[model samples]
Target: MANSFSGADMSLRTDKAVQRGPALQFTVDDQLVDAFSGESVAAALFAVGRRELRQSPRDSAPRGMFCMMGSCQECLVWVGQRQVPACQVPVAAGLAVQTLSFRRQHLD
Candidate 1:
Protein backbone atom coordinates (compact mmCIF):
# COMPACT_ATOMS: atom_id res chain seq x y z
CA MET A 1 0.00 0.00 0.00
CA ALA A 2 1.23 3.46 -0.86
CA ASN A 3 1.77 5.80 2.07
CA SER A 4 0.48 9.35 1.95
CA PHE A 5 0.63 12.25 4.38
CA SER A 6 -2.57 14.11 4.96
CA GLY A 7 -2.62 17.89 5.44
CA ALA A 8 0.02 20.62 5.11
CA ASP A 9 3.66 19.71 5.38
CA MET A 10 5.59 20.85 8.42
CA SER A 11 8.68 23.02 7.88
CA LEU A 12 10.86 21.00 10.20
CA ARG A 13 10.72 17.85 8.07
CA THR A 14 14.18 16.54 7.35
CA ASP A 15 15.82 16.76 3.93
CA LYS A 16 15.60 12.99 3.81
CA ALA A 17 12.35 11.90 2.21
CA VAL A 18 9.76 10.34 4.46
CA GLN A 19 9.06 6.74 3.56
CA ARG A 20 5.55 5.44 3.77
CA GLY A 21 5.44 1.76 4.43
CA PRO A 22 2.75 -0.87 4.62
CA ALA A 23 -0.08 -0.37 7.09
CA LEU A 24 0.03 -2.45 10.22
CA GLN A 25 -3.01 -3.85 11.98
CA PHE A 26 -3.35 -3.50 15.72
CA THR A 27 -6.21 -3.79 18.13
CA VAL A 28 -7.08 -0.94 20.47
CA ASP A 29 -9.92 -1.19 22.96
CA ASP A 30 -11.03 -4.36 21.15
CA GLN A 31 -11.33 -2.49 17.87
CA LEU A 32 -9.04 -3.06 14.90
CA VAL A 33 -7.14 -0.06 13.61
CA ASP A 34 -4.54 0.53 10.93
CA ALA A 35 -1.24 2.20 11.69
CA PHE A 36 1.77 2.73 9.51
CA SER A 37 5.09 1.08 10.09
CA GLY A 38 7.43 3.06 12.40
CA GLU A 39 4.52 4.89 14.00
CA SER A 40 4.32 5.08 17.76
CA VAL A 41 1.40 3.66 19.73
CA ALA A 42 0.37 7.13 20.79
CA ALA A 43 0.37 8.28 17.17
CA ALA A 44 -1.75 5.29 16.16
CA LEU A 45 -4.27 5.98 18.90
CA PHE A 46 -4.49 9.67 18.18
CA ALA A 47 -4.94 9.03 14.46
CA VAL A 48 -8.02 7.04 15.33
CA GLY A 49 -9.32 9.73 17.70
CA ARG A 50 -8.47 7.84 20.86
CA ARG A 51 -7.55 10.69 23.17
CA GLU A 52 -8.00 8.73 26.39
CA LEU A 53 -5.17 6.25 26.66
CA ARG A 54 -5.68 5.51 30.34
CA GLN A 55 -7.19 6.82 33.56
CA SER A 56 -5.63 8.21 36.69
CA PRO A 57 -4.73 5.47 39.15
CA ARG A 58 -6.03 7.67 41.95
CA ASP A 59 -9.46 8.73 40.67
CA SER A 60 -9.99 7.38 37.16
CA ALA A 61 -9.46 10.67 35.37
CA PRO A 62 -8.79 10.23 31.65
CA ARG A 63 -5.20 10.60 30.50
CA GLY A 64 -3.37 10.73 27.19
CA MET A 65 -0.15 11.85 25.52
CA PHE A 66 1.69 14.60 27.36
CA CYS A 67 5.42 15.20 27.55
CA MET A 68 5.57 12.50 24.86
CA MET A 69 9.27 12.09 25.45
CA GLY A 70 8.45 9.62 28.26
CA SER A 71 9.00 12.10 31.10
CA CYS A 72 5.27 12.08 31.89
CA GLN A 73 3.41 8.80 32.45
CA GLU A 74 0.10 9.90 31.02
CA CYS A 75 0.13 7.49 28.09
CA LEU A 76 0.31 4.31 30.10
CA VAL A 77 -1.14 1.17 28.54
CA TRP A 78 -0.93 -2.60 28.72
CA VAL A 79 0.53 -4.90 26.12
CA GLY A 80 -0.38 -8.32 27.48
CA GLN A 81 -0.26 -7.20 31.13
CA ARG A 82 3.05 -5.39 30.71
CA GLN A 83 2.66 -1.68 31.36
CA VAL A 84 4.32 0.56 28.78
CA PRO A 85 4.32 4.19 27.84
CA ALA A 86 2.53 4.42 24.51
CA CYS A 87 4.57 7.28 23.15
CA GLN A 88 7.69 5.15 23.40
CA VAL A 89 6.29 1.98 21.87
CA PRO A 90 6.45 1.37 18.13
CA VAL A 91 3.41 0.08 16.30
CA ALA A 92 3.43 -3.66 15.57
CA ALA A 93 1.07 -5.77 13.55
CA GLY A 94 -1.52 -7.75 15.51
CA LEU A 95 -0.60 -6.01 18.75
CA ALA A 96 -3.27 -6.02 21.45
CA VAL A 97 -3.37 -2.77 23.42
CA GLN A 98 -5.56 -2.26 26.43
CA THR A 99 -5.86 1.08 28.14
CA LEU A 100 -5.68 1.07 31.91
CA SER A 101 -9.17 2.52 32.00
CA PHE A 102 -10.57 -0.46 30.12
CA ARG A 103 -8.91 -2.91 32.41
CA ARG A 104 -10.31 -1.20 35.47
CA GLN A 105 -13.77 -0.99 34.00
CA HIS A 106 -13.99 -4.67 33.07
CA LEU A 107 -11.97 -6.20 35.89
CA ASP A 108 -14.28 -4.73 38.49
Candidate 2:
Protein backbone atom coordinates (compact mmCIF):
# COMPACT_ATOMS: atom_id res chain seq x y z
CA MET A 1 0.00 0.00 0.00
CA ALA A 2 1.16 3.51 -0.65
CA ASN A 3 2.26 5.51 2.32
CA SER A 4 -0.30 7.94 3.61
CA PHE A 5 0.59 11.57 4.01
CA SER A 6 -1.53 13.61 6.42
CA GLY A 7 -4.93 12.28 7.45
CA ALA A 8 -5.89 11.52 3.85
CA ASP A 9 -4.24 8.89 1.71
CA MET A 10 -1.70 9.94 -0.90
CA SER A 11 -3.88 10.45 -3.95
CA LEU A 12 -2.63 9.81 -7.44
CA ARG A 13 -0.76 12.76 -8.88
CA THR A 14 -2.91 12.70 -11.99
CA ASP A 15 -5.26 15.11 -10.29
CA LYS A 16 -2.63 17.82 -10.28
CA ALA A 17 -2.82 20.37 -13.08
CA VAL A 18 0.91 20.06 -13.59
CA GLN A 19 0.41 16.41 -14.54
CA ARG A 20 -1.28 17.44 -17.78
CA GLY A 21 0.03 16.08 -21.04
CA PRO A 22 2.77 13.44 -21.33
CA ALA A 23 5.64 13.66 -18.89
CA LEU A 24 8.92 14.99 -20.16
CA GLN A 25 11.07 12.31 -21.78
CA PHE A 26 14.79 11.84 -21.09
CA THR A 27 17.59 9.35 -20.52
CA VAL A 28 19.19 8.31 -17.29
CA ASP A 29 22.65 6.77 -17.55
CA ASP A 30 21.95 6.43 -21.30
CA GLN A 31 18.70 4.56 -20.76
CA LEU A 32 15.67 6.22 -22.30
CA VAL A 33 12.71 6.63 -19.98
CA ASP A 34 9.76 8.86 -19.20
CA ALA A 35 9.14 10.98 -16.10
CA PHE A 36 6.51 13.48 -15.10
CA SER A 37 7.44 17.08 -15.65
CA GLY A 38 6.58 17.60 -11.99
CA GLU A 39 8.87 14.79 -10.92
CA SER A 40 12.20 15.55 -9.34
CA VAL A 41 15.59 14.39 -10.64
CA ALA A 42 15.56 11.36 -8.36
CA ALA A 43 12.11 10.25 -9.48
CA ALA A 44 13.34 10.11 -13.07
CA LEU A 45 16.32 8.04 -11.98
CA PHE A 46 14.22 5.50 -10.13
CA ALA A 47 11.85 5.18 -13.08
CA VAL A 48 14.86 3.98 -15.09
CA GLY A 49 15.66 1.16 -12.59
CA ARG A 50 18.58 3.05 -11.10
CA ARG A 51 18.45 2.60 -7.32
CA GLU A 52 22.02 3.51 -6.53
CA LEU A 53 23.06 6.67 -8.24
CA ARG A 54 26.05 7.27 -5.98
CA GLN A 55 28.01 5.95 -3.01
CA SER A 56 29.63 7.40 0.06
CA PRO A 57 33.41 7.30 -0.07
CA ARG A 58 33.79 6.72 3.67
CA ASP A 59 31.50 3.72 3.99
CA SER A 60 30.91 2.92 0.33
CA ALA A 61 27.23 2.36 1.06
CA PRO A 62 24.85 2.51 -1.90
CA ARG A 63 22.95 5.77 -2.01
CA GLY A 64 19.87 6.94 -3.90
CA MET A 65 16.31 7.72 -2.95
CA PHE A 66 15.70 7.44 0.75
CA CYS A 67 13.30 10.11 1.89
CA MET A 68 10.98 10.77 -1.03
CA MET A 69 10.50 14.19 0.55
CA GLY A 70 14.18 15.11 0.56
CA SER A 71 14.57 14.79 4.34
CA CYS A 72 17.29 12.15 4.49
CA GLN A 73 20.85 12.36 3.33
CA GLU A 74 20.75 8.96 1.65
CA CYS A 75 19.50 10.46 -1.61
CA LEU A 76 22.17 13.13 -1.50
CA VAL A 77 24.05 13.92 -4.71
CA TRP A 78 26.00 16.56 -6.55
CA VAL A 79 24.37 18.50 -9.32
CA GLY A 80 27.12 21.00 -8.65
CA GLN A 81 26.38 20.64 -4.93
CA ARG A 82 26.88 17.83 -2.45
CA GLN A 83 23.98 15.71 -1.09
CA VAL A 84 21.22 16.83 -3.44
CA PRO A 85 18.16 14.63 -3.25
CA ALA A 86 17.20 13.00 -6.53
CA CYS A 87 13.53 12.61 -5.66
CA GLN A 88 13.11 16.29 -4.95
CA VAL A 89 14.75 17.37 -8.15
CA PRO A 90 12.83 17.82 -11.40
CA VAL A 91 13.78 16.21 -14.71
CA ALA A 92 14.97 18.54 -17.41
CA ALA A 93 16.21 18.13 -20.95
CA GLY A 94 19.96 18.08 -21.59
CA LEU A 95 20.65 17.20 -17.98
CA ALA A 96 24.17 15.82 -17.97
CA VAL A 97 24.29 13.36 -15.11
CA GLN A 98 27.54 11.86 -13.85
CA THR A 99 27.59 9.01 -11.38
CA LEU A 100 29.78 9.62 -8.36
CA SER A 101 31.02 6.34 -7.00
CA PHE A 102 33.35 6.21 -4.02
CA ARG A 103 36.32 6.05 -6.33
CA ARG A 104 35.11 8.83 -8.58
CA GLN A 105 34.43 11.30 -5.76
CA HIS A 106 37.95 11.03 -4.40
CA LEU A 107 39.90 10.65 -7.63
CA ASP A 108 39.38 14.22 -8.68
Candidate 3:
Protein backbone atom coordinates (compact mmCIF):
# COMPACT_ATOMS: atom_id res chain seq x y z
CA MET A 1 0.00 0.00 0.00
CA ALA A 2 1.21 3.49 -0.80
CA ASN A 3 1.88 5.86 2.08
CA SER A 4 -1.28 7.87 2.59
CA PHE A 5 0.57 10.82 4.14
CA SER A 6 3.61 11.79 2.16
CA GLY A 7 4.90 15.28 2.89
CA ALA A 8 7.36 17.35 4.83
CA ASP A 9 7.40 17.25 8.59
CA MET A 10 3.99 18.69 9.56
CA SER A 11 4.66 18.57 13.28
CA LEU A 12 5.24 21.81 15.13
CA ARG A 13 8.45 23.45 13.98
CA THR A 14 10.49 25.60 16.37
CA ASP A 15 12.75 27.29 13.90
CA LYS A 16 13.82 30.87 14.57
CA ALA A 17 11.79 32.03 11.60
CA VAL A 18 8.64 31.25 13.55
CA GLN A 19 7.92 33.83 16.24
CA ARG A 20 6.11 32.67 19.39
CA GLY A 21 4.93 34.25 22.58
CA PRO A 22 6.36 33.69 26.04
CA ALA A 23 6.66 30.15 27.33
CA LEU A 24 3.84 28.73 29.41
CA GLN A 25 2.80 25.46 31.00
CA PHE A 26 -0.43 23.55 30.81
CA THR A 27 -1.73 20.17 31.88
CA VAL A 28 -3.10 17.56 29.52
CA ASP A 29 -4.57 14.42 30.98
CA ASP A 30 -2.96 15.47 34.27
CA GLN A 31 0.46 15.60 32.61
CA LEU A 32 2.23 18.93 32.48
CA VAL A 33 3.26 20.03 29.00
CA ASP A 34 5.22 23.02 27.84
CA ALA A 35 3.59 25.42 25.43
CA PHE A 36 4.17 28.81 23.98
CA SER A 37 1.79 31.72 24.12
CA GLY A 38 -0.74 32.16 21.29
CA GLU A 39 -0.68 28.40 20.67
CA SER A 40 -3.87 26.36 20.59
CA VAL A 41 -4.23 23.46 22.96
CA ALA A 42 -4.12 21.04 20.06
CA ALA A 43 -0.89 22.50 18.79
CA ALA A 44 0.69 22.31 22.20
CA LEU A 45 -0.29 18.70 22.63
CA PHE A 46 0.87 17.78 19.16
CA ALA A 47 4.22 19.43 19.78
CA VAL A 48 4.84 17.15 22.71
CA GLY A 49 3.66 14.02 20.86
CA ARG A 50 0.34 13.72 22.67
CA ARG A 51 -1.54 13.12 19.48
CA GLU A 52 -4.39 10.95 20.63
CA LEU A 53 -6.89 13.51 21.86
CA ARG A 54 -9.87 11.28 22.38
CA GLN A 55 -11.38 7.91 21.56
CA SER A 56 -14.29 7.32 19.27
CA PRO A 57 -17.54 7.12 21.22
CA ARG A 58 -18.97 4.25 19.18
CA ASP A 59 -15.95 1.97 18.73
CA SER A 60 -13.31 3.33 21.12
CA ALA A 61 -10.90 3.90 18.29
CA PRO A 62 -8.10 6.43 18.71
CA ARG A 63 -8.66 9.88 17.33
CA GLY A 64 -6.55 12.99 16.87
CA MET A 65 -6.77 16.34 15.19
CA PHE A 66 -7.97 16.03 11.62
CA CYS A 67 -8.78 19.45 10.23
CA MET A 68 -7.09 21.47 12.96
CA MET A 69 -10.18 23.61 12.56
CA GLY A 70 -13.12 23.77 14.91
CA SER A 71 -15.46 22.23 12.35
CA CYS A 72 -13.89 18.75 12.55
CA GLN A 73 -14.61 18.19 16.25
CA GLU A 74 -12.00 15.41 16.36
CA CYS A 75 -9.87 17.09 19.00
CA LEU A 76 -12.47 17.47 21.72
CA VAL A 77 -11.16 17.57 25.29
CA TRP A 78 -12.35 18.44 28.76
CA VAL A 79 -11.48 21.72 30.40
CA GLY A 80 -13.09 21.74 33.79
CA GLN A 81 -16.78 20.94 33.43
CA ARG A 82 -16.94 21.95 29.80
CA GLN A 83 -15.87 19.89 26.81
CA VAL A 84 -14.29 22.02 24.11
CA PRO A 85 -12.41 21.47 20.90
CA ALA A 86 -8.66 21.51 21.48
CA CYS A 87 -8.11 23.26 18.18
CA GLN A 88 -10.31 26.16 19.24
CA VAL A 89 -8.96 26.89 22.69
CA PRO A 90 -5.68 28.75 23.23
CA VAL A 91 -3.27 27.41 25.78
CA ALA A 92 -3.23 29.26 29.09
CA ALA A 93 -0.87 28.81 31.99
CA GLY A 94 -2.08 26.36 34.59
CA LEU A 95 -4.89 25.26 32.31
CA ALA A 96 -6.09 21.73 32.92
CA VAL A 97 -7.11 19.50 30.02
CA GLN A 98 -8.30 15.91 30.09
CA THR A 99 -9.02 13.43 27.35
CA LEU A 100 -12.51 11.92 27.26
CA SER A 101 -11.01 8.44 27.51
CA PHE A 102 -8.97 9.49 30.52
CA ARG A 103 -12.05 10.55 32.42
CA ARG A 104 -14.01 7.52 31.32
CA GLN A 105 -11.30 5.11 32.41
CA HIS A 106 -10.81 6.79 35.75
CA LEU A 107 -14.47 7.21 36.51
CA ASP A 108 -15.34 3.62 35.74
Candidate 4:
Protein backbone atom coordinates (compact mmCIF):
# COMPACT_ATOMS: atom_id res chain seq x y z
CA MET A 1 0.00 0.00 0.00
CA ALA A 2 1.09 3.54 -0.68
CA ASN A 3 1.65 6.14 1.97
CA SER A 4 -1.52 7.82 3.28
CA PHE A 5 -0.24 11.15 2.00
CA SER A 6 1.18 9.93 -1.28
CA GLY A 7 -1.30 11.80 -3.43
CA ALA A 8 -3.41 13.45 -0.78
CA ASP A 9 -2.41 16.95 -1.82
CA MET A 10 -1.91 16.17 -5.52
CA SER A 11 -5.17 14.45 -6.31
CA LEU A 12 -7.17 16.39 -8.83
CA ARG A 13 -10.50 14.78 -8.16
CA THR A 14 -13.19 16.92 -6.66
CA ASP A 15 -14.41 14.29 -4.31
CA LYS A 16 -14.18 15.42 -0.71
CA ALA A 17 -12.50 13.32 1.91
CA VAL A 18 -14.45 12.05 4.87
CA GLN A 19 -13.90 14.16 7.95
CA ARG A 20 -13.74 11.96 11.00
CA GLY A 21 -14.61 13.66 14.24
CA PRO A 22 -13.09 13.08 17.66
CA ALA A 23 -12.30 9.65 19.02
CA LEU A 24 -15.33 7.40 19.31
CA GLN A 25 -16.07 4.92 22.05
CA PHE A 26 -17.08 1.32 21.58
CA THR A 27 -18.06 -1.23 24.16
CA VAL A 28 -15.94 -4.34 24.37
CA ASP A 29 -16.95 -6.79 27.04
CA ASP A 30 -18.63 -4.03 29.06
CA GLN A 31 -15.58 -1.79 28.82
CA LEU A 32 -15.88 1.49 27.00
CA VAL A 33 -12.92 2.21 24.72
CA ASP A 34 -11.59 4.95 22.51
CA ALA A 35 -10.21 4.57 18.98
CA PHE A 36 -8.78 7.13 16.62
CA SER A 37 -10.01 7.82 13.14
CA GLY A 38 -7.08 6.25 11.25
CA GLU A 39 -6.55 3.41 13.67
CA SER A 40 -7.29 -0.29 13.16
CA VAL A 41 -8.94 -2.57 15.68
CA ALA A 42 -5.72 -4.24 16.79
CA ALA A 43 -3.90 -0.93 17.08
CA ALA A 44 -6.64 0.53 19.19
CA LEU A 45 -6.70 -2.49 21.44
CA PHE A 46 -2.97 -2.34 21.94
CA ALA A 47 -3.10 1.38 22.61
CA VAL A 48 -5.43 0.71 25.55
CA GLY A 49 -3.37 -2.26 26.87
CA ARG A 50 -5.64 -4.93 25.38
CA ARG A 51 -3.39 -7.56 23.96
CA GLU A 52 -5.36 -10.75 23.63
CA LEU A 53 -8.59 -10.45 21.76
CA ARG A 54 -8.88 -14.01 20.48
CA GLN A 55 -6.97 -17.28 20.27
CA SER A 56 -6.48 -20.23 18.04
CA PRO A 57 -9.30 -22.75 18.39
CA ARG A 58 -7.02 -25.76 18.44
CA ASP A 59 -4.16 -24.50 20.56
CA SER A 60 -5.86 -21.58 22.30
CA ALA A 61 -2.78 -19.46 21.84
CA PRO A 62 -3.13 -15.69 21.99
CA ARG A 63 -3.83 -14.02 18.66
CA GLY A 64 -4.67 -10.60 17.37
CA MET A 65 -3.50 -8.34 14.57
CA PHE A 66 -0.11 -9.26 13.21
CA CYS A 67 1.63 -7.79 10.18
CA MET A 68 -1.15 -5.18 10.40
CA MET A 69 -1.94 -5.43 6.69
CA GLY A 70 -4.74 -8.02 6.56
CA SER A 71 -2.25 -10.62 5.31
CA CYS A 72 -2.64 -12.63 8.50
CA GLN A 73 -5.82 -13.94 10.04
CA GLU A 74 -4.58 -13.50 13.58
CA CYS A 75 -6.72 -10.43 14.01
CA LEU A 76 -10.08 -11.87 13.24
CA VAL A 77 -12.80 -10.51 15.54
CA TRP A 78 -16.56 -10.65 15.37
CA VAL A 79 -18.25 -7.44 14.46
CA GLY A 80 -21.87 -8.05 15.38
CA GLN A 81 -21.95 -11.75 14.50
CA ARG A 82 -19.92 -11.33 11.33
CA GLN A 83 -16.24 -12.13 11.32
CA VAL A 84 -14.37 -9.02 10.25
CA PRO A 85 -10.66 -8.55 9.64
CA ALA A 86 -9.50 -6.34 12.47
CA CYS A 87 -6.28 -5.11 10.89
CA GLN A 88 -8.17 -3.95 7.85
CA VAL A 89 -11.20 -2.63 9.67
CA PRO A 90 -11.14 1.08 10.33
CA VAL A 91 -12.20 2.33 13.73
CA ALA A 92 -15.89 3.17 13.81
CA ALA A 93 -18.38 4.35 16.37
CA GLY A 94 -20.75 1.93 18.07
CA LEU A 95 -18.95 -1.10 16.71
CA ALA A 96 -20.21 -4.22 18.43
CA VAL A 97 -17.32 -6.64 18.74
CA GLN A 98 -17.28 -10.31 19.73
CA THR A 99 -14.49 -12.83 19.95
CA LEU A 100 -14.83 -16.33 18.54
CA SER A 101 -11.39 -17.56 19.56
CA PHE A 102 -11.47 -16.33 23.10
CA ARG A 103 -9.73 -18.49 25.68
CA ARG A 104 -11.49 -19.87 28.71
CA GLN A 105 -15.21 -20.50 28.84
CA HIS A 106 -15.82 -16.76 28.87
CA LEU A 107 -13.26 -14.01 28.62
CA ASP A 108 -13.10 -11.62 31.58
C-alpha TM-score for every candidate: 0.76, 0.60, 0.84, 0.68
Give the runs in model 3 whose Cα sits over 4 Å from its true position: 1-12
What lDDT tens digits, residue by residue, belong to model 1 across residues 68-91?
778798898888878899999888
Better of 1 and 4 by TM-score: 1
Best by lDDT: 3
lDDT of 2 by residue, 4-89 (tens): 12112213333555534345655444444455566677766665456787777688777777779978867765554454666666
For model 4, state the Cα shift of residue 80 in Å. 1.9
Return the top candidate by TM-score. 3
Tell me the tens digit of each residue's lDDT in model 3 across 2-99.
32211232245566789988878778767777778899999877876667988787998999998998999999988888989999999999998888
In model 4, the Cα lDDT at residue 90 comes to 74
Instruction: For each candidate in turn, give its C-alpha RMSD to the true structure in angstroms.
Output: 5.7, 8.8, 7.5, 10.4
Cα displacement (angstroms), candidate 3, residue 80, comes to 0.9
lDDT of 4: 0.64
Model 1 whole-model lDDT (C-alpha atoms): 0.74
Which pairs clash in the backbone of model 3? none
In model 4, which regions exceed 4 Å deviation? 1-21, 102-108
Residue 66 lDDT in candidate 2: 78
